[model samples]
Target: MSRLRTPASPAYLRVVRASAWYDLAVTAGFATPWTYALVHDALSSCGNALGLGALPELDLWQILFANLMGSVVVVWAVLRIVGPLPEHGLFDGIARALFATWQAYALAHGVSQLLWLFFGVEVTFGVLQLVPWRRGGNACRARMRNADHRSTGRSLT
Candidate 1:
């Protein structure tokens, strides 16, 4: 896909959907305390072995917040996968920026280095969705023109 393609383009829509899939795959396990405990254990063991500092014992507040975030992200990911609208890309990009910033803050505070993996993916998707891909190219122009025609009680061939 061309980096400069409009958000309305198929390429851009696919990018948005892909990000949603990534989110679903990574966060779905965090939606419940049981699953989150398992995930937490796995991460802690790996981090410790790699000298990356294991997560502290899961606290009640931590589990609550994790569950909330996981539930919200799962629903959001489902929406994007079902209907990847151009506007969704914009909003998701903004959300990614916020996530990346928070991830950075956590890293600074000595969180496990494993978080850097997620942080990198967030930054990449954030840039991909945030780039001002608007209003150019034959494909986008033709699609928009068709929509405009339909809105005006006409049809384009």
Candidate 2:
């Protein structure tokens, strides 16, 4: 009996689309507090209240800087996801690694234990992004091999 099978979309595309959604969520989460003084102060106070220690006091410039950085991440993530380029995944993976590492270091030293949740999410998603990328690369290689065999009049099997 033959089994019915539907071809799956490329793994990298699925990953990138998911990543875009995640990035938008992160942007919304970060942008609000960084943009508003009341929210910013509340968040900073919450950190200290949670025994994570006091967050840095942000002046207007610092607040803008933080918001700007968050905006950049949002834009970059959107571009990569919309375009779904192979190299873009690698680039985002590397950036996410650095962000996760920094967050982990800070949490370990008690800089902000509250950020542990952020670190976990970032690390998890970052690794997830890379997994599909590698699979996609292998799939490409296999396709190339099959094509070469066909060109040489050899049976693909």
Best model number under lDDT: 1
Per residue, candidate 2 scores C-alpha lDDT tens digits across 57-154 of 76777677667766787788778667765556656777889989888777777675667767887887677666554554565456667878989999
- Which pairs clash in the backbone of model 1? none
Clashes of 1: 0
TM-score of each: 0.83, 0.65
Tell how far residue 34 is off in model 1, in angstroms. Answer: 0.9
Task: Tell me the spans in candidate 1 whose CA falls farther than 4 Å from its real position.
Answer: 1-4, 134-157
lDDT of each: 0.87, 0.65
Candidate 1 global Cα RMSD: 4.7
Candidate 2: list runs displaced more than 4 Å: 1-11, 28-39, 45-54, 139-157
Alpha carbon lDDT at 100, candidate 1: 99
Top TM-score: which candidate number? 1
